[model samples]
Target: MSVHETPRRPLRVSFEFFPPKTEAMEETLWSSVEKLAPLRPDFVSVTYGAGGSTRERTHRTVARLVSETDLPVAAHLTTVDATRAEVDDVLEEYWQAGVRHIVALRGDPPGGLGEAYAPHPGGYANAAELTAGAKARHDFEVTVGCYPEKHPESPHFEADIEMLKRKVDAGASRAITQFFYDNDVYERYLERVRAAGIDIPIVPGIMPVTNYKSLMRMAGLCGASIPRRVARLFENLDGDPATRQLVAATVAADQCLDLAERGVGEFHFYTLNRAEMAYALCHMLGVRPT
Candidate 1:
């Protein structure tokens, strides 16, 4: 069978985490990291807050992971509300902290979530610029984000693909899509990306619905659709934590398995600072502690 038709590629997984703002949250994040470390994800990424708001926190978290764990760490960098020199310094810091991978992004608009994005006058214009800068700084394995449902600001899919092509031209090595529910959306997107001559690994981003309400909010913001069938699964479980957890795991595992059947081997999970769901999903996908 052709590689695309056969599920022969080994399953590979990675995770993304956000920096904590409080001491209690910090403890929880570390605990989650500890539990997930045994699975040996391809890499663990720490996210930069909107407009670099959590710059120091993100740096500290990523540096600690680099020093404390054997897993590869990818530090996220954004071209939001910062000068080129400032971003350069942050890149330098990541390099000094033993980081070799970067998740480069244009980040959210400086005004806030709903505001129109405007690049800082003195900073890199967008992810393409940031990706190029990181490449110039070091031999970093740069990964950029793609949207299967289309970015909220992009005029259309064609324009969105063009922007992604720019990132690829600027030296991005991989692309992890925004969280999406339907494997078909991802499958179609992969076809478009490949047709555009973009040849990087397009990893699917899986978000286990920990809280239905929160998932709705995020989905709205990121342009990910809520399939009626999937939404129906969580319709009446708002107050049941235990049941919600079970449902979330079952649904996410099914999503991954369906993708695997289509020969998708890499997954980047948005952990949301929780380990149980990701750990369970990884186990379901045949990743176990070594």
Candidate 2:
């Protein structure tokens, strides 16, 4: 008898976290990190707040991760409300702090989404320029964001693909997509990206839906659409945290398994500084601790 192997590549997962604002939240973040670290993620990224609002907090969290853990940490850099020199200094700081990977972004304006983005007088205009600048500064492995449903500011998906190609040309080693629920949407976007001749690992961003209202809000801002069927799954679980957690895990697991069966090997999860759900999802996906 012939033996058929799994026919799937080993799944590689990474996570994204935001720097905490208070002592309690900081503890929670570290606890989550400790809990998820055992699954052996490829890396964990720390996010910068809008317009560099969480600049110092992000730096401190990243630096602490460098000092305290054996896990690889990626510092997020943004060209929002900061000059070229300012951003350069932050990059240098990350280097000195033992962070060699960066997730470069053209951050949202301080006034928030829908507000016009104005590049600082002496700063990089967008993620592509920021990627180039980081490459020039150091041999950092830079990753940039792409949107599967098209960026809110982008005129269309074609333009978004063109901009993504520019980022790759500028020096991005990989592109991690914005959080998306629809695997078909991601597959279609991948086809376009490949057709456009952009060759780089495009990791799907996964956001587990623990809070329905918050997820809807974020989906609106990032241009990710939630399917009506999935919406109906969370219809009556609003007040039950226990039931919501189960639904969230089941939905995320189904999504990941579908992508895996489609030959997707890498996943970048937006953990939202919570570990239980993400850890549960990883466990469900067979990413158990070594």
Q: Judged by lDDT, which candidate is best? A: 1
TM-score per prediction, in order, is 0.96, 0.95
Residue pairs in candidate 2 whose N, alpha carbon or C atoms collide under 3 angstroms: none
lDDT of 1 at 35: 94
In the range 47-112, model 1's lDDT, one tens digit per residue, is 998778989999999999999888899999999999999999999999999999999999988665
Computed on alpha carbons, the lDDT of every model, listed in order, comes to 0.90, 0.89
Q: Residue 126: error of model 1 in Å?
A: 0.7
Per-residue alpha-carbon lDDT of candidate 2 for residues 235-287, written as tens digits (9 for 90 to 100): 98988989988888889989988887777878889998999878877776778
Query: What ranges in model 1 sit over 4 Å off?
Result: 1-9
RMSD of 1: 1.7
Task: Score residue 267 of candidate 1 by CA lDDT.
Answer: 83
Clashing pairs in 1: none
Looking at candidate 2, the ten consecutive residues that score lowest on lDDT are 1-10
